[model samples]
Target chain A: MLGPHAPVATPEQLAAAREAREAYRGGLVAPTSGVAHGLVQANLIAVPRDWAFETLLFAQRNPKSCPVLEVVEPSADGRVEPRLAPGADLRTDIPAYRVWRDGELVEEVADATAAWAEQPLVAFLIGCSFTFEAGLADAGIPIRHQELGTNVPMYRTARQCEPAGRLSGELVVSMRPIPADRVADAVAISGRFPAVHGAPVHIGDPGSLGIADLGAPDFGDAPEVREGEVPVFWACGVTPQAAIMASRPPFAITHAPGHMMVLDVPDAAYAA
Target chain B: MLGPHAPVATPEQLAAAREAREAYRGGLVAPTSGVAHGLVQANLIAVPRDWAFETLLFAQRNPKSCPVLEVVEPSADGRVEPRLAPGADLRTDIPAYRVWRDGELVEEVADATAAWAEQPLVAFLIGCSFTFEAGLADAGIPIRHQELGTNVPMYRTARQCEPAGRLSGELVVSMRPIPADRVADAVAISGRFPAVHGAPVHIGDPGSLGIADLGAPDFGDAPEVREGEVPVFWACGVTPQAAIMASRPPFAITHAPGHMMVLDVPDAAYAA
Candidate 1:
């Protein structure tokens, strides 16, 4: 893989994403920003088999924010199947994993074999925007946060996701300001990738979603909206984190923000 | 409301669905097939609050077969508020309810108050094809089973639903034979109503979905396929019943196949 933070790779490099997964599994502990440009990048969430039912429901109920690509059940021999990666190890494919206990993040580790080995755990690979952003870029629309070299601005919206079981929380959204002329193109492009967070949930007026300040966000840096550009918000994968904080399960794991798991599938596989 | 086996109501009659709800509350116990022509019809599934998490997950995991319109948690005063109906008492809104204990159907009753009163129960209102069938009829597509005045033929498929907790079973699909020329129109019509078992899961061959015979089905009666027609299958709401049987949950409640809860919202409201 190219040096960390290199611009998004070419189609050929993305098709050969096993190298990126190799970099992660072989102890490269950096955020997976641009490792495999045209492949799926997943946000990770792991919970014990006992808690797996509700957590999976949490993602399923809020599909916009948590479109699950595949769930590796602890009972299924816990093998990392090819829906994402053919030979990937669910316990260590990501660059980093965060361990949360009782709603508090307690540890960030390069691998989670220790936690996973003790008890059967279900690993959920939720769709993230890396593939859709690649689609957006290919469609000639620029991604603001990537160009700025910062995390996508995310905010907790007033919109409530349909509650399922013990998991319920406000929908969290990531913002990208596209030129007014390109907003339709942006929607058309992103809408095709529903497995990733699809079309803009809200297109205008921050207050409508209860986001107080465009300059201040609940997570990530402020977005840079250009003149004649509109802020387009898509459901963010970080929603599971907010849900975790609210539901307060005893044990959980997630990928550190921006440190995603690079999957082996081509991004085109996710396009609707 | 009309008697059992009444003709499908006119649009104006559907607009007055509250009268149907009243008939149900006033001890008129009959299947609700023709009660409200243009309103939404839902399948009911109730489990204790402790089992709700897993049951909800099962629906979320198998959305095509079990589209949940609303979930009334026992913790929330447990009164049903249909997104489609206001001031509806879920306990009596449906004409008939089936009680299952240890995976066996033990009783069919008009009122579940006696069972529901003793313990907190979470009721799940699942999407059914009443609205989509209306769309199909409007599009000039034939609904073979409905035309024959029989239940839609349902079969156990080889494709297993993504298991959630203790709920795992082969997907159950309802079959309809649309004229070969109109299959596209059938899909286009049903695709608009995502809330009501959107679109066909499989088309053309019953064997593709693991149905051994078109003349024989595991649950519903066999379907009659006309010349120049193709068998189209949509995920059936009976899926949860199969899951409950497979998982063997201690107690559960479901609507009898032909009995449904009529909601107040217009069918058009569910169109995408």
Candidate 2:
């Protein structure tokens, strides 16, 4: 309903997001990779009104993994538009939406309005690593998963996120194996963007985070570990979803894996 | 009763704080200057347990001025210190304490143990600019107020802080006039330390922030504004103090102006 659908493989970022948004409005379900080049993409979560404050505090305390972009305060008034995407509807902007009841996946819908119809929901747009990944790539650092055309490997680590009231769970991290030489460059580049998940939380040994097996990821596709490459783990936005599942919030909504909300902010806005 | 008294201006930071703490514990009323020469000193606020969350969120949202060092959750069990200072009692560490009730300063006491005695109090240690000031001085930037031997001039501005539930008020800023040539260095030096007030919220044109008179200040001693030197305003820790007064919380405790809790953390821990 916004742009066009099924963007060309190498479409420009905004054009691609607009096209993808258009496709999504027309009931198209697809991942938003390479859609909006140089723009910040975000993970979306919608939860009951009562759980909003605790969730906000949880993200605030553990900002690396769950940097809040826009929090639409929960209200009985319903469906307040966020300023992140102008003229875009939160319920219909993303390619696909997942509805979870009592933390279990109940349905996948193109539009969330139907399931979220009467419920008082607070929507949170969380910073995604896609923007920083663009920075890493711009710096000439290789993104192993991108190179392999697979989802970035994510793991549920032993590192517990700071509990905010009732919301508490283990931190989740997405691993990006970098050539040994580019590790410092990667950290320095990403460290500047605290609004997004900044810098690698853990580098080299996965064992330090209690990540038992690198090949066996809890979420997303595992990437090939190259010679001379070390696995760097950055806090992942999916952390809240895992926390929600563990905390069991009764009802919730999230973007399908890899299906993010494309914001108007350029990825470079987050660069130092 | 921890350290000593009147550290010979150049005593080691830890030794200096120890001396100052000893003097305060011995009921010697004095300002805590040159006490912890290179250590981070904090602004302390102890409020009721029910108001702790809102206060934490207020500080989280208005971080530049209210960068939290550690929040000791209010428990009926009494003062539980953070690792900021081991064996340092929150009740007796600072030189002086201010007690507020129903938004009015009720007493300025030698010790808060009596006023904050038995109630469940949540103590918040907020970052102070002294750490960043150390960095600026390191870069050869002149600290006008420090040189003049006075409290930094603070002003209440028209800028509204992001409110958390009941805690909301106008922003308060501390002004330091930087020589035109060194303003950039001052910003660069301070920006690295976000834990303390980082960078100038307003650099030039005091009118832009709705301050009509440079000579008149809301709090602290007024400094002579030099010609050709730009007045740089940084968010002040006094902001939460003003907010507490405005919000009229049942009871609150704060460090008497310039009398801060000398933390064990060296000033460099805050450096970027």
For each candidate in turn, give its C-alpha RMSD to the true structure in angstroms.
6.4, 6.2
lDDT of each: 0.77, 0.78
Highest TM-score among the candidates is held by which one?
1
Please estimate how well model 1 matches the true structure, expressed as its whole-model Cα lDDT.
0.77
**Over the full model, what C-alpha lDDT does candidate 2 score relative to the true structure?**
0.78
Candidate 1's clash total is 0
Cα deviation in Å at residue A198, candidate 1? 1.3
What candidate 2 gets wrong by more than 4 Å, as runs, is: A1-27, A45-54, A89-92, A95-124, A147-149, A162-167, A226-229, A245-257, B1-12, B18-34, B46-53, B100-106, B114-122, B226-228, B246-251
State interface RMSD in Å for all models.
Answer: 9.0, 8.9
- Lowest lDDT sum, 10 consecutive residues, model 1 chain A, at A1-10
**Residues A1-272, model 1: lDDT tens digits:** 11122244356775557776777778778656556777778888888767775676677567789887777655367555534566778677787888889888889888877777766677788888766888788778888878888777889888877666677778889888999999999999989887788788889898999988988988777889989999888898888887887778888888877778787666667665
Q: What is the TM-score of each candidate against the true structure?
A: 0.84, 0.83
Looking at candidate 1, what is the lDDT of residue A27? Answer: 74
